[model samples]
Target: MALQNGFVRKEGIPPKSRSRRPAPDRRYERLLARQGLAPTAGVDEVGRGSLAGPLVAAAVILPLRIRLHPWLDDSKRLDSRRRLSVCDWLVGLPGVAYGIGFASVEEIDRWNVLGATMLAMSRAVLALAEKPGVVLVDGREAPPLEMPVRAIVGGDRRCASIAAASVLAKVTRDRWMTEVGRDHPRFGFARHKGYGTDDHWEALRRYGPTPLHRRSFLGRLSEEAIPHLPWDDGAIEPRGGP
Candidate 1:
C-alpha cells in the first residue's frame, strides 16, 4: 500500500502519522488515585481564541482503569470523524461521567477570555450531577471549583480524562458554530468554527459582525477600517492586541 505523507491516511484515524505526540494516558489519574482522589474529573475548554460564538468547556470522569482509543491525545490532534467517534464512545461508555458548559460571546467580552474560560470550566464542573473528588484541568490555571483542582500543562495530551473532555468540548462547540453557519452562511462559521480565518475576516469586512462576534476580539485583531467598532466593551480590561 502506498503511504501518504509517511503514513497511510484513511477514512478514520490511523495508528501512525507524519508527526505524532504521545497519546493521553492514565499516569496522572493513577498518581491522583493513589493520593485518594478516586473520582477525578478532567476539565478542558475550547473556542477561547475564536472571533465569534461561545466559549465551551467539558468535564469528564472515567473509570479508574480502562482502555480507550489507542490514538487519543488532544482534540486538536484528531480529525473531525475521529473526534466525533471518540466523543460518542466516551458519552456512551459505561462508567464515564461528563458535563458541558458554555460562555456566550457577551460573557467573553464581559469577563475577558481568561476569566470567561475559568467561568466556563467552573460551569462545566458544576453541571455534573455529582462532583468528582478532584479536577485535573488541562491548563496551568485552575478553575474556581469547589473541589480540589490540579492544573497540568498539556493535560489534554497527558491525561486520558482531560483528553476526553477536550474532544467533547471541541465537538460541542464545532457543532454549535456549524448550526450558526446555517443562519449566516456568509461568515463561513462552519468552515472555520468561528476562528479568525481569512474567509471569516473577509466576511466580517464585507458584512460587519453579527450578534455572535466578540466586539473586543474584533477591535483587537482587525484594522481600524471597520466603522463604529466597539474598541472596549467596558466589561473587562481591554486585553490582547494586533
Candidate 2:
C-alpha cells in the first residue's frame, strides 16, 4: 500500500508504506524471447551480504505460459510463511526448470564474496536442465560465463523470472541455515540466518567464530579481544562492513 521512497515518495512528502514492490512482469523475458531467446533463465543469489554461511544462487526458467503468483516479489519483501509457500509452488509447478548452486564459506574467504557469488551463479546456470539462450541476472554485473548474459539492476523487482530465482535461492539457503543452526545453536543461525545481528554478535564474542563463520568477515570483530579460531585471518578485509 506504500510506494518505496526511492521510486515514488517525494521529498518532504509523507512516506507511503507499501511493503512489497509491484509484481514483476515478463517484459524482459518477452523482449528476449521475441529475439529467439525463448528459453531464458533468470539468475539471482542469496547470502551475498550475510556475515556467515554459504552463498546460494539459483537460475529459473518459466514456461511460455506463466501466470505469476500475486504474492511473488523479492525474497526480502516476503514473510517466512509466504516465502515457503511460493517456493513450494514454484518448485512443484509444471514446465518450470530450475537449478540451485552454492559457494561455501571457505570459497568466500579464498575468492572474496563477489567472486564466490559469481561462481555460484555460474554453477546454477550450468546445472539447468534446459540450456538458456540468455541469462537475466539481477545485479549490475553479470557473472563470467560462456553465454549471452545481461545484468538488470533491481531485476528481482522488475522481472518475473529473476524474482522467482530470488525466492528459490532464498528459501533454499534459509532452510540450510536453519538446519545448520540445529548443529550449532550458539550462533543463532536459525534466528539471523548468518547475518550479523545483535544476538549473533554477542554469540560470536562468547563462542568465537564457528566453521560457518567467514574469517574474512572478522574485520568488525576485534582481533585482540576475541578468541582466535583455528583458521583466523590476521588481516581480514573490511568488505560488507558493520
lDDT of 1 by residue, 70-103 (tens): 6566999999999988988888878788888888
Give the candidate number with the greatest TM-score.
Answer: 2
Per-candidate TM equals 0.84, 0.86
Could you tell me the TM-score of candidate 1? 0.84
| Model 2 Cα shift for residue 187 (angstroms) | 1.4
Model 2, stretches more than 4 Å misplaced? 1-20, 232-242
* RMSD values, in order shown: 8.1, 7.7
Clash numbers, per candidate: 0, 2
Q: lDDT of each structure?
A: 0.82, 0.85
lDDT of 1: 0.82
Question: 151-236 in candidate 2: lDDT tens per residue?
Answer: 99999999989999999999888888887678687787988899988888888888788777888987888976577685644332
Which candidate tops lDDT? 2
